[model samples]
Target: MYAHAKEVAEGMLGEANVKIASQNMGGEDFAFYAQKAAGAMFWIGVGNQTTMERVRPLHSPHFVMDESALPIGAAFHASVAIEYLNKNQWCAA
Candidate 1:
């Protein structure tokens, strides 16, 4: 699952563009969903690399996301869904 997601993401974005972040100690609320089903979460980079500044850390004041990655994220998401459906025959016709 991780490999498929990573490949789809890298294909839509780029090799260097898609990064696997280091593991974090903090847990996400999404963990609840994983208890019921197999799943993986992706984090898209939305930082302002141009400014190289941090207005505030995540879950803090003034945290914002760059909308520039929307198309890339959407493409990756579609690719993942299509690939999974094809592989699993979830909507085979």
Candidate 2:
């Protein structure tokens, strides 16, 4: 599943720009979706800004998502969906 998704993602968003997220400790419950059908979840980087000489964690008062990642995330989803649908005729294109 990821093999195809990664191919589509890297194809649309250059191989150099693609990044594999690390440090996934406790797995996400979202994996349950795969049991019903082929499914995958991916991450998009929102960048970190230095705050008080350190990078703050998520949900912090100063934490903010870099808007630049929005377009990339949108494009990634579109590309993955298009590619997957192309391989399988889930519905009319």
For 3-85, candidate 1 gives per-residue lDDT tens digits of: 88888877777798887888988878888987897678997666776775664567877888677867777878889999877
Model 1, runs deviating above 4 Å: 51-55, 90-93
Q: Compared with the true structure, what per-residue lDDT tens digits does model 2 show for residues 8-84? A: 88897789977787766865787787889887777777764543345556769986677777998898888888888
The number of the candidate with the highest lDDT is 1
Candidate 2 clashes between residue pairs 3 or more apart in a chain or in different chains: none
Runs with alpha carbons beyond 4 Å of true place in candidate 2: 48-55, 90-93
For each candidate, what TM-score against the reference? 0.78, 0.75
For model 1, how many clashes? 0
